[model samples]
Target: MKYRRVKPWLVAGGCLLMSACSLAANLNYRALLVGVSGYPGLDAKLQLEGPRNDVTRMRGVLLQRGVPAQNIAVLADGVPGAELPTRANILGQLDRLASTAKPNDYIVLHMAGHGSQQPVSPGSPFARDEPDGLFEIFLPRDVGAWQNLPGGKGGAVQNAIFDHEIRAAVDRMTATGAFVWGIFDSCHSATLVRSAGGSEEVRMRQVSPQDLGVPATAMDRATPRAPAGTVATAATAVAPSSGAGSVAANRGGSAFFYAAQTSEPTPEMRLPAGHPKRTSHGLFSFVMMQALEGGAGMSYRQLSQYVLTRYGGMNETRVTPLFSGTALDSAVMGQDAATVRQWKLTDAKELTVGAGALADLEEGAVLAILPTPISGLSEAIGYVQVSRAELATARIEPVDYAGIPKKTDTELKVGTVGRLVQQAMKFSLSVGVDLQQCTRPCAFDAPLTRLRNAKPGEGVAGAQVQWVAPGQAADVRLTAIGDRLWLMPPTLGGQQACTLRPMALKAACDDQMERSLVSITLGSLASPGNAAQTIGRALHAASRAANLMRIASALASSPTNGQVKTSVAITSKGGRRTAYVAGQVPRLEDGDKLLVTLENTGRVSVDVTALYLDSRYGITAMFPRGLGASNRLESAASDSFELEIHDDTLGLERLAVIAVEAEKQSERADFSYLAQPSLPSETVTRGGNEADGNALFRDAGFAEYATRGGRPAAVSARTGMQVFSWQVVR
Candidate 1:
């Protein structure tokens, strides 16, 4: 056979693959799973009935599929809600497991529990005017809810987690070039029905315990009615006798697969207390176990077909899997030969970690936390915990080698905030392209590769690139430039190959392009071979909680009196992605502490907002010094804006945000925006579509606040009254 000339880049992962090929048995692959039930507060209402079993069974399936016994790690399988683990603790566990992960290794997560939602505002064309939807999962033994949730009076029951939190975790893992997968079996009603550009009809999700035999009185009295046109999305399929249990929301992504449809029920059966078999698992689990035990060598599609064909249309319970793949018409199929072979490792290793075992390691050992020491030249350093056997064989000292550190092409500065805004751009690009070596510039004349092709935002980070047409040639170069890892063709005609058009305000535009979403940028803060859940949670809480004022102020100003007339009134709304509600009570002041109760309504733990008023605005107040929740700076200025945010609660819990004002009266005007306090102007990074203009007002009376930090609080000749505009994520 004639040999075809191939470029070095074309070999792709050739070195890694060759090494793996040398061994008869595939390399080890691992996973860590944690699920909790028996909550004290909502335990009687939103109990976890299915996910625990599903996750437990999944452990067995992975082991049978060839995952090594030592490779899999699990924590808190049967922990109750009151005893659920802390966010930091869970993250610490995942970090330890990540130590063994290698580039291209697959990491999977399976969660089962409860979910919550926020009330929908009026005029939300896409929703039925119900509560804003929030999705979340449980932390084993977690005693309280997130501070941001509703009705979280410091002692309320904690709920589950949502897509944002999970995506944050996935972003951290995939950045290491490791394939990350998550299987969430909680109730997902909080997810918007109209996202992903799908038809509104798709949002008509099935009802869960609400439809079961549980009395209406047993349901949350706070459950808001769906808007006029969309009243059917409630979970209504459960038998009346069935009580409220945990559920998951439906969020799609190229890197994720939902085992059930948006409108279908994920069922769980109560086994006889002393039954010989398992105690409680849902229909999905039942079918999934059968497929794995058979070892039929079936693809995802074939296996799904087997399950559906065998159990479709069965009386009280039925199962469906919503897969994202190339089959278009079939919802399955289309695995490239190469990609299939890469994922085949999962089939070769027998998952050995039991569901009840704790990882022998901790997070500090497995993941490196990226340190922002200087501008652009940022690097990551971390360590992975390992058994003495692996450490000795890997050859390097375990502690030192465990830390994975890399220096990008850019200089990185320490002590800078807004890193999340800077990282979002990186994440966006990472999700749309493959980052392998290329020797030449991609030909402009060649067919363009659209990075936005796959399920645009599945809440997971990673790109899936397939040749649009066979034999398409668009060889390109991927390199590290500044902090940016550039994906472009090699030098073309002695100049950079790709022509990137910068937006107006050149400096701002450059920063925007180079920024990765806070959820995904893991340099300095992450460790290799391990998941970085801690950094992810901290960043997520900061990014989202920081926006509470902007959203709250936007709604507070929309009414005629510029005040929240009721305790909480749903007001302006746009699409399914965001909603604004107004709640006007006694005006808050700087140093005047206020306590607000919230709850985590989603499946994943949520980051909610609690606003405090600062009477003045000043440079110190604008840039108050603080090192997390414990050591925050108090501004004496009369008009500065400030708020405190926390993460850990899963259900009904409470926390407070104290907004301190500048010490001077003149500064008071600088801290207020609308009748309510708006978010700090610098929060969202004022830009073309992402700017929140309403935030430009320092106080209700001022024309506008400065866009970049440290500018005068008052509008200047060079600055307009409004420096930013509100444009929600579409």
Candidate 2:
């Protein structure tokens, strides 16, 4: 069955799809073929009728493909010895024909014109094949002359259409749901024509009875019938000699077929004059017709093979064909063009949405929408939902998609489709947030302060506290507040610290904790100091909270002076918490010991870091892998190292405290957080030049080697966030 282009209608809420079947939803049988036989100078004028016969032969083949005689349009230009039509006229006709097509429509255009080559500028001799690989199509009338004619309209040859223009045309038409098939018979400079099998030599002994839709014995003069053996193999569709194999050539909907590769050229016949009654078309078309007329029921691939067999035995010129294009709905064109005889079109209407109307849809996610049938459109748009998995597959990252526009609502349109569900489905995703700074007193500290008798019931309040390593460098501040300590960075001053570790400096990290909080008040701190506090009361809450028994015990026994230890635990409140201990001990360290704890109640995952303050000195420690994943710590000033606590090494945890041991010397200890935090690792440049996108860490040979080996690489920001993502497709 032949395919037609049909436009669908839009329904309410962009929910309903157009009812009309997509134009390209069927097989293609109709074609508009044009063959030109004009060559101005390279050779003598062509007989005034060769192109006409060529067009006629094409028409016959199309008829065999199931296209009605009236459906195949032929435009023959410059019949032997006749002047060819103007370029403008030829293009104009083509444009008009193309305009009549709809989405889902398949249009095949064949051109068989004389071609030659010359310099791009004047005064240059005829150039058969230009060095840049461009062969020009010559017009009929140039008599062995390289110069323009007296009429200022010399019959000069021009390269076939430019790729840009062709792509532009294809884009415009295909956007409306049409597939264009362009067949070029003229020789291209890059690819030379080669000999092929001719179907004419396959002698036919008798026409099969099944092949006769009409009487086999009474052959129509216009449609020749071949003998038995020849008839069986007559229309063997062969793949293009350019190595393009054919599939079943026919289907219920749109299809495209060509006779040559975009880079190669097709050959033309050398004809004689005097208006002969019978003339051979170009090798490609002639053989193509044999497959159509033979009624062999051969697949496109089979037809190609048949043509190849004939060409191998024939004395005349032989040429092959190529085919490639989209099929609508469920149309399949296997290797044999003749076998492409059926279409599995389901009357079930397929309404589709266009990307244009999908502007309101949420980007970077799968938007599952229920399709509703509209009067004008085949499908309907009813409801839409978003899925993150779909976004990842489509490469729709948060950075790539546009921010949600400030609109009340918008409908996404789905174009024509064969089924209800489509990869292009659209959905709406609304985003909103509530921000809270750590500067404010956390609820947990309120309980601890009350238990410690520090001003009734107030939340955790403190000067500010930040994690730090004893000897390593870092910038962080910590203040005492009631019975609980809190972070006091000016940017987000006075927020309660949830864990003993510092936050992984990232904007997304902040957002993840907007609704989360960490606090230590009285029993909430869960440490030995929480045992019904006395005297100084809430004064030492910051230190007590940091000294959680489990962490304090583990750190004291660690062995390596430079190795840091990190661990995660779940709090009674259902929040996840992290703890850290530095591997180095401080010299002249204060007798005061600072301990802290952190717990996250928010939904997002976070990596913990530490900033230690030693009497105004700052030290930073880092755990690259989130707690539980790895016990390794990538020190601020050292390579990645791991810290583990064995049964015998538990004693090292107590020795980890700088002030704890210093207090044993009977000396007053002092400590204050620093402002500068320790950075995790050395920065690396992707490539030596700006264009190179590969990157690696300092002294990281594996990363560099992988990049040079064409492996994917990503960019890590100073904040430890990935800025750019790379992936190798092949």
TM-score of each: 0.31, 0.28
lDDT for residue 417 in candidate 1, whole number 0-100: 14
Give a tens-digit lDDT track for model 2, residues 1-730. 3534333332212112332223232544346666655433232322233445667656644543444555566656644432244455455555665566565465566665543232232232322112232223323222233333455432322323322233334444544555545544443221222212111111111111111121221212111222322211101111111112222122212333444332233444322101122243555555555444332243333344333333222211112334433442222221122221111111123222232111111222222232333222223233222222211011111111112322111243333121212122111111111113223544333333343343522222221222232211111122224434322211122332232111222342332222111222333334333322321222222222222121222222112211322222212122323332121111111122223323222232223333231111112232223323422122332223233212211000121112111112232211111122211111112221121112112113113112342322221111111000000000
TM-score of 1: 0.31
Give lDDT: candidate 2, residue 153.
32
User: What is the Cα-based lDDT of residue 66 in candidate 2?
Assistant: 41
- TM-score of decoy 2: 0.28
Q: What is the lDDT of candidate 2?
A: 0.29
Q: Stretches of candidate 2 above 4 Å error?
A: 1-30, 39-49, 63-71, 78-85, 117-168, 190-278, 296-306, 315-730
CA lDDT, every model vs. true structure:
0.28, 0.29
> lDDT per residue, candidate 1, 378-441, as tens digits?
4433322211112001111123432244322122122111111000000011111222222334
lDDT, model 1: 0.28
